[model samples]
Target chain A: MSAALFSPAAPGASPSASPGSPELRAQFPILARKVHKQPLIYLDNAATTQKPQCVIDALTHCYTHWNANVHRGVHLLSQEATEHYEGARKVVAQFIGAALPEEIVFVRGATEGINLVAQTLGRTQLSKGDEVLITGLEHHSNIVPWQMLCAERGATLRVCPITDAGELVPGAFDALLASRTKIAAFSWVSNALGTVNPVAAMCRAAKRAGAITLVDACQAVPHFAVNVQELDCDFLVFSGHKLYAPNGSGVLWGRKALLESMPPWQGGGDMIASVTFEGSTWNHVPHKFEAGTPDYPAVAGMATALQWLQAIGLQRVQAHEAALLAEATERISAIKGVRIIGTAAAKASVLSFVIDGVHPHDIGTILDRKGIAIRAGHHCAQPVMDRLGLAATARASFGVSNTSADIDALVEGIVAVQKLFGA
Target chain B: MSDLGDLYHDMILGHAKAPRNFGKLDPCDASALGHNPLCGDRIGVTLLLSQGRVTDVRFDGSGCAICTASASLMTEGVKGRTRAEIDTVFQRVHDLVTGKGDPEDPELGKLAVFGGVSEFPMRVKCATLPWHTLNAAFDNSNAPVSTE
Candidate 1:
């Protein structure tokens, strides 16, 4: 990599647009914490990211100042809460380049967002013998929901395979997009392997084949910019927690026409236009899908998270993570018996690896001793592990706050594991 | 942070590198697979039972050091023991790893190396995978048992 990649801006300095600025790390309070009497080196961004102080403050501000149920009351607290909540929706819509704010539906996380689509859109659009084409590189959330949709609708789920290098097998997706294919859902970035799938191309092909496309952008949204219009996907889902917001916050951005046509998957107080003992009419598009009392503070916090990320600039974050990934890949691969899994040409923040004699769980344990945090398992994408013929791999995924020093710490941790295993 | 010595004692690492009785038995009548869905540590335990005793026991699969070492030590502990004896050993090992069994239980012997497993709560599953699979094998349950 470049020498500039290793150098970070001085700590406690003003924010700079340049990659690996110390100001970026200063914004997150958790990054200052210690683990095991050592400075924490958190590299598990694919699981979730650390929230910046601004996002945390935004959550507290929402609860402290504007705590009220959204969109229902004509009272002042309710109106202020409603404004911020709807404001967050508009911000999310703009972040993803959705056609309208109504196209963005709030869900618990990417898992729930996907399940909403699978139940509402998939249930209505699919028929018996219809195939939902997903890739072999899906997290269980993406896989199981479609499986349930298929099982309930008498449809089938088909997978497009991946190569040994973890890239999608070329032309496999197109080959599987047969006449009966109904929906084609895939990840924009593989959470397990860090492979950045050719989502725009895949979505284009799926659309040409008359299939609705849903891009699981859970991993993608954190590391880089995602413009839904640019990708031209019918539906896209991402978790707010992965984007440096709190848990229980996520977005499912769909085309307005599609959301309009689909019936609400859930029934609750807020989702109804008119409710009787025996009958009910659904509310408007986005509200129709979001039922019950929403987490308004989380919604406000998610908006702040988006704004914080915007201030940092996604391009800078992408470059910063890419540099870290390159440094990690080079350093970790240089170690004997350490094989880096998922060598896709275009990967973002994730670096998955396995030592020849040491199990990933052991690697995780050893790393934890040195105050390093990483995910050690199939990464909820067991299908990817199954495809790679590995039970599990130790994964170190990057975030905006990570630096080359963190990567160095990770390398040292791996060396310690090798020594422990006598590899 | 956990102390590495407590979790991966020398004996555990040694047995992991070269586990004993690690292969499928040809004449095995009872066998069951155990899988740790969390880490994908799979252990296929094969038992050759004669009358009411486990005449021969073997296990084969891929797993972490704790799992492999536990399996290897268990083979030495369970061989030639009656089914009831094996059950007691299993219970003791389970209790020992979970920090609930008597450490001075003389029957534990070499198996006591895993007593440190309780220090790292997450690793208890890794240490106990083979024992659970052994139970399933003895019970003649074909379905894979999962340590979720």
Candidate 2:
């Protein structure tokens, strides 16, 4: 297990890229430290992840060297900050395979990105009784915005249910694609159950129905090569903090025409082109949505984070993470009293499970004391929890830095809980 | 690294396996249902009050071992006690499980093992669901309140 942590044909010096080399681990300064005197077996990648030294260095440079407000500065420092910030936009655009940089709008994260789409798109076209086709596996961020929109405009929210096996029934999504369905918002990967949804195929189906498609790619982007054009999705969103960048930064990429048609979400500074105290004109596609003074430094950090991810190569990362997932599911599922959820054929690095008698919260607390960090709760997907007939689940997600030994720590922790609970 | 104290003590496991008042109380003077939806821990709290004093207390629900045990233990500590005395117990349990301070109150003997739970922030709600329901049941202003 230790030898096979994340090494699947080393992608050069990147940790996990090289088999049997721990040098990549040093890039992340936090992995060396221990919690409760035990080495930190960090597995809660679904919630967030530890930043690499490159990302941390970018953050430091933004504050220590080229610190300035973006889009409005005239001095050298401001010019440098503006260049780096826009450079981040280009990096993010390339990362998602967007056709143009202006199509990418930097928002806070996935939550705000969803809210922006719901508010703008729903208000623009959706009328009362129109339907929004979503799945039972959607996170609260995806569900709540549509709910609020539906309630306001008398539009109804339609749910695409999942099978007992936790896979999205192939044509089940197609069945929900009614003529009344205006927008189809779904997570590219189910955060709760680690179900990797086929967004490209699903979006193609939605396009055939004339219903617009949007994806919450927060979970998918970190592990896979996300090509918005390949997906053919009308709109795609993801967060920076979850992508190894600093907090308060994310990207919402849409087709140029689709973004141009949408209205501005918030009003204030930086979104307007001209103000005469009589009538104000909005900026271009991306700038029109990015309101107020944005998190410039964080955006710079995100660019650097994307660089690090690209350095490892997304395809290699995805394959390695998938291999790790396969090994983990095989071993962890065989344990008595351990029932893994989301047994879908397609899955990301996330693994959610429940022990027979131990509460998820209890499992989390016990794991934390042992310095093995895992996310335990509903994972902000209460609807999925309800669908599975559970209140919460213990989730262990993998990242580039995660090793097979981390899974061992998790199994050991579960065994300890079983011994204590007499399960 | 999980201690028996962190998961369950012998008494808590015993009570959770078989709670004392594990049935519904008919014609109950006060009743409340508390659920930590996060954990699917649901408890029906029924109170039989005699002139503002808690003459009888019973709770039945489904949850994990720790929560079920905590709920079972809660019913025993508050039976035949006054509202004023029960409030103190609630506060003590909240503090103990939530990691504040325990003042050696005899009612909190076996419950003291839960003092180790505070380090884990997510489980605090699970351990306190029953106690919160008990407090709401004592308050007669409304029907069963949601102690989220």
Candidate 3:
């Protein structure tokens, strides 16, 4: 309201201020909401995002018209279904700058996508002496899978430490990338801390060391202009829900030859070339990873979600979200006893912090009562919590639909928590 | 931001801010740690039992308002009550949380306020984490209960 307020978004710009930002928010009817008799301030995009009208429409469109099971029948509906399903692949490929459609294997989301690679790629190559390089700033979804993979094989899971400011120390990451390092998997943008890793350089370093790099773009894809080609990582994964797409749908993009060589991770119907009682010949690359009845409705919604982002342009979304993050960071961090967690020099649109002496859960409950949705806890990044010597931290992540008004509400809500805790 | 005051009645925030009998018991004989890694709620319930009565009960946990309050309330409710009485209270609270049990168990006392938690599916765990931790900690008790 004052001249002192610094709006990162240019004049007349909102989160959905991109070309189709308004239309996209319109698609996600939930954005039009009120909470606890107040206007909804959804700062929990990092947790899960509100779906736009197009994503909702696409989902409804599939069930309303062509709801046939894909990759089974050769009927008119089946052909239509297959075309739309495969079309989504191209949409996602273009969305992330993947080299080919085959590289983008549709999984249940980033969690499952990470598990798929850890199970398949990890199983095939990782041996006892082999070290799986990862950072302490990973979600349990990223850490647990490799732990299981390493436990299954004789492999070891090595961690790259984070700096006090929450950025991954580049030199430490490089130091961890030794000869035994089979793979280096880290979040392109950390979910808990919102620290965006130096992907292009990090991936380049990993590649030179002959290690497969898996980038969890779950948080990044929603807030930044991410290009798989630009990063040139061996594999990249992101979730649909974070990108304003439906849940149970995600993309796992790998280099062509590397993904092609791996066997099917899960086996059922569509992933098979020929099914015999004794043995089954596997299908091609994408299908090989995509086993059983995929979430067609969700995939349809996800494709539209990506298309929605494309229409708005990633750069505009980035700018809008960045402004929100900066405004929120400066305002919320100024609150007494509230320490901002991740202070990476270069970051995306997430503002994570913890109110001193106040458990994040208490802060979360207080905020939710005010109808301001924010994520509080380890954020599935237990390793990060362990490093920070914290049980949990509260995170307020941004999206295109968010506004300065929401940040104001969040600041007020956090102040309430701080005062209540006497922090 | 208007205060949704009813949701954060002073009692709830009061309990969360300055919990009664907070922190772990050193010689925790019957202690079990139930962790909700999703929300990072961890509760360590130490039951100081003698014969059948719970005698003096204590809990140490770090979690949201509801979970900590629930843990605090449990220590108050179960103290001086027999093992069978504790079992009944646990069932009442479990049902109140997981939606399988009745929220309106008359003996549940002020703890019944958490019944509204089922409205928010995610917070169900927040409401139930302490109760679940209590059950798990009393695993050897086998005192006829249902968390279903």
Candidate 4:
């Protein structure tokens, strides 16, 4: 693809003006495709990001060259696979600013990462009358696992409420964090509303309240930088697909001492040090968490994706997406009878809104016909939706590859939807 | 683009905008609730039957345009029809939306406006949730039907 294809600049304008340069966008091959006979305009980045060629090539290379199990066999392929997998762990550790590579455990996604913590650490620490505190803005992935854990352990689940602007109510976390709160978990960036929580403050408060903290950085990691040490959270998790890697690839970064102290959630081949009919000893911290065969290729691809983002620099990606979000919010808000949801003072690139008379599904369908893909639903965060008194909202989430032109197309699509519905 | 127009036909849009019989029926003989968990669309169907015929029917809920319009059209189509007749009509409507039944089938009447829904497979559930709730209501099943 030509550099001009990805350029946000108009004809004869300089391409260097945008953060998502033509060079960056060209690396994503799928961006060249069409949908419904129109150029594909992907605005559903919050769902999953389109992969760059480097990440795709890495996946194919792993399978083609050294398709073998890791940390088991002494053969050449096995050794090579083991090296690649371990090397990817190192890259992930650095990407998220982990103190040690062993702290980075490979999981299917952020959902599994949270479940691992809830089942292992939660099962051990939580007692009857103990509480698990979460925010109203968490996705279902963050909410359901804790609910299951609380049910089994006879623990109470507390929720910190958010405001009409989709931010956590001031002092709500402090109010909810009691001495009996065993764990405090929340998303660094909300998937449904794009609200960026005060993670550092929340973590400190939780620590002072004698609660273990877990940060769901699935949305934050892709848009910006996340350092576990700086945040001082006990555990942090993110999915690779949202970072332009393969699906079923993720990282769970926990404090090394805490991970070592907690028992493994699942047990199988790689997670065991030795097994007898009567008893078994578990492997090290990460391997104990990674049961059976891991998706080594996916891990390798995730590493490549992290490297790709690192090379581009996340600050630039953040700035670019912020611009897109501002543009979308300004344009969409100007339309009569349109209401923007989640009007938080601080947010990421997700722009969710509702029309006065049109349902979100209709807006999604109309946009789909125009080859503009936007998410329209509760975003698996039904509580957030219910808290806001909405069934669903039309969400247009920006990614690195997106441009101002895409936002213009989305605006036009929304206008067409309103006209069709006579709203 | 014209295909989108066909899918959101004037009849469908009209019904979605101002749905007919769009409120709860008090003291109904049989009632059933339908939910599409994927999109959080809910449709509660209430009907009064006499001599195996639907004497009165009303629906109350909020959902996407297709779902709301489907429920509105369904209430109109099922009134005065017996259980067996309603079953046959539902099957025809189902086939019509799923792209199996003939679009020009005279038996379908105004319900044929949904013929375009077949092109969008994901929307088949939206167009059928009301019908499923209607079936459940006829059977007097208290359990809420879900299109997962």
Candidate 5:
């Protein structure tokens, strides 16, 4: 099939079309379920999204049909399995607008993807007195790996600050991109605050300063289209689960030259070209980074997820989520003592807020009683929380399947929490 | 959802709002930090041990009502108790929260507010965090204990 068949939408897709609806909601089996005798309103998409039925079917189909080890096997089942596995890579490449399928490396999710780059590229490229630039709004996954790399290399982690609105401070990236900066790794969207960074601009600044750049797109890919080529970053990463696929699948897309230059992250079977008694020759580019037996079933499911998103058209999905977020921000902000964090002029579908004198855990518990699933805590972005002067906040992130009614339910749940806590 | 009354009883809320022994314990011999990474709930337990007895046991941190209440009640229950006696109370509280001990166990007393924790399995960690910090403080272990 043409890769364009799975592209978001052509020019003719009507802008006024309703992006998400009850019909789209029906495609997800878990949405039909309930918690506490009420229907589940899943507003935790930033953490992980619910898988659609088609994605689940894709996983089942992989095990049912092509249930065999890939790459080296000569049998028909192995060939078919290998075909599906590599085909999934091609789908991911097309999904991200990668230059070649060889640029895509499959791993266990965005965490593993970031770790792979940090261990391999960071180990080789970084040295004493070098610097790795990051933002204050990064998830722990984006921050910790780089911190470890800096510690190992005797380099320092320089953080670009964010405004009180939770957006990256203007000109902070340019100020932090020193000549000794080795690589600048940043999240395309703040997982905690939903503050979308100007990734392309940041990447350009880093590149101009002679530093490599990596974009953590784990939060971005699920909500809208991400063309890696357009962003012009040396690397980009995202997890499959955030994109409505299975949990164990994630994509790490690096420039072909960078992947070839960086040593294989882990020593294993598929990543070796030839093993000598003395030393072994490493495999090429993407395969060099992807070690051990891959999660073939999850990759197959990820392909289906991309196709499903494209069929619905990501533009519409973006519109739908944007609408939900706008409505949520308005309604939640109207509540007394509820302060919305990350009030950037531009944001995605995540709405994080704090109610005066009410702990987020209490809010989460009350929301749970009403069958509303929202995330509470620092959201694995402790630095952001620290910067905001809060221990934690309640977050409601919308996905393509979410609707205005879900936000309404969340507001009602928050009201119930206020009543319970006397906030 | 079990009754919020069961989990967040009036006493639990009262303790959460006005936690007893809630401040720092200066001139303490042993202090340990317990953190629940799942919810970012952190509690610091500081014990001023005099002659092998907890002369002043205080905790300070941010967490849910269950966690704060448990820590507050723990300080109150362990004040002036010997190390051996505190361990016994800790064991009983753990059992009560895990649904393995008597709800009416008089030893728990006000600590019985945690008996409802078994109904919400996830909250057990919140209720038990301060207890773990207390044990860590007793052992003089500086490593921050985690409930994972």
Candidate 6:
């Protein structure tokens, strides 16, 4: 909780000289375990990050001390639970630089967050002949919801294409933006490829086009810092599990005016203010969106994860992960018959590649045998795969606890795969 | 219990490297597509069925090593066999891959190489996808078969 923990070189640091300091690795208990009789080298951070002991302890503490439904009872345990839940919202608001905590709504994860916006705000704003603009680099979560919304409202879903290097094509967004564009949604960083989109510039363009913007920050939030106020997007959403917190915990931050204007997506116990046999009134901004009993423990865990990241400082995390990614990219590219996907000039910490005469599933299986885990498939971005003319690619995404040694192991595993396939 | 060596045996690798009966069979009696949505592995099976017997078979698509090799070996195994005989072989192969039947069972023949697949629960579907597609082809069903 103190700024002192943000020091680049903490006291009693190991002299072994690892990019991800040994001290940081020690905080995650799973890193110490073995898989297949070998030390586990996890490289799938983009899918979901490993939780630190502090976050796990926070979940346990909340469940043990105040295991009650939030915001309903006047009992001490209920008050404590409500306080922790609301406190988590404030932490998320501050972490993402929202103007007020009331703008943040807790949900199951990024998928739910996007669906909520698509159903509520999209239903209210969209009509016939309107358009919902998205990019070709979006995950299925971002694409399907907009498609559903457009189909329901008789609107059109327009897609901006990406370059061969996986970057958004130059001037494609502007060309696609027209008077009919009602909402523009794109990912801040692609989960399949590491391409980092020009979010602020895109937001500015969307605003000028008289369109509301929603940024999928699930991949961006874990790798670096995000300030919604500076980006000036109308809404942003991210998941907690990708940030080293528990699953089923996430945040959807919208402009206060927009959240107040949209209707509640789901209806249940907590989202309603008053109820009669015939009708019901909705609660305030965030609570109106959060129906039923929330996952209070997960919220507390997410708050602890945010505080832990703050203590480490996102800038340091960004630097460490970038160094690892650079080393990985350089070493992996040197191998014969290996191709790197998504060669964007600007990217986050994801490394995706394909080897000649070898399928990604085979690569993943061989790597898993060596205790080096990576994702190998379309990664739920089939459109991106189709664009790249590939069935799938093997992806190794880095995290704060990853070191150069993990990258070395990955390179060795790739060599072994090539040998196995005789490529 | 399954090692990488056993999973990627020499036979599996050889068959995968140069798959047999790979291509579309034009003017065939029936054909069906098998898709594994989980890994995006797809394979199509086409055969010439006459008098309730498979005279010729061909399979073509993209898939992992296990899947590709399984489909290759299946094309060679199922040729010149009746539908009931092919079904019998499919049951034994299913048991062999699931570790329920003896690996040394004389009925398995070259399919014994897949005895290692049982160790990987996830790969079971990959090994069985071609057989499922073949079943669909016999029925002449146009709907694609998915190993969900």
- State chain A's TM-score for model 6: 0.96
TM-score of only chain B in every candidate structure: 0.95, 0.87, 0.80, 0.98, 0.96, 0.97
Of 3 and 5, the candidate ahead on DockQ is 5
lDDT by residue (A25-65, candidate 4, tens digit) is 77777889999899899999999999887777777777777
1 against 4, candidate with superior DockQ: 4
Worst 10 residues of 1 chain A by lDDT: A1-10
* Candidate 3 wrongly placed segments (more than 4 Å): A1-27, A419-423, B1-15, B23-29, B76-79, B88-148
lDDT of 6 by residue, A294-384 (tens): 9989988898888788778888889888888899999999999999999999999899999999999999999998999999999999999
Runs in model 2 deviating more than 4 A are A1-21, B1-7, B37-40, B98-103, B107-110, B118-122, B141-148
Native-to-model Cα distance after best TM-score fit, residue A227 in candidate 5, in Å: 0.7
Q: Which of candidates 2 and 3 reaches a greater lDDT?
A: 2
Error of 2 at A384 (Å): 0.7
Predicted complex 3: CAPRI docking category: acceptable
In order, the first chain's TM-score in every candidate is 0.96, 0.95, 0.93, 0.95, 0.96, 0.96
lDDT digits (tens) for residues B16-94 of candidate 1: 9999998999878799999998888999988888887888888999999999999999998888888789888889988
Top candidate by lDDT: 6
**Distance (Å) between predicted and true CA of B98, model 4?**
0.9
On a 0 to 100 scale, what is the lDDT of residue A4 in model 5? Answer: 32
Local accuracy of candidate 3 as per-residue lDDT tens digits, A37-109: 6667788888899876666667777887777888889888877778778888988888888889988899988
Model 1 chain B poorest ten-residue lDDT run? B1-10
In terms of DockQ, the best-performing candidate is 4
lDDT string for model 1 (A36-64, tens) is 78888998989988887777777667666
Model 2 chain A is weakest, by summed lDDT over 10 consecutive residues, at A1-10
- lDDT-best of 3 and 5: 5
Candidate ranking under lDDT, highest first, comes to 6, 4, 1, 5, 2, 3
lDDT of 5 by residue, A247-351 (tens): 899989999999988888899889999998899998887788777899998998898788778777888888888888998999999999999999988899899
Model 4: chain A TM-score against the true structure: 0.95
Per-residue lDDT for B1-148 in model 6, tens only?
2488888998999999999999988999999999998888999999998898899999999999999999999999999999899999999989988879799999889999999888777788889999999999999998999998
Candidate 2 lDDT over A1-423, as tens digits, reads 111111222224452344213766777789889888889888988899788777776767677877788888688877777777787788889889999999999999999999999999888889987999898889999999999999988999999889876778778899999899999999999998889887888998999999999899999999999898889999999999997888988989989998999999998788998988798999888999998999987887788778777877788778778888898898889999899988998899999998987778778777887899998878989888878888889999988877788778888899887877687
Interface RMSD score of each model: 1.7, 2.5, 2.5, 0.7, 1.7, 2.0
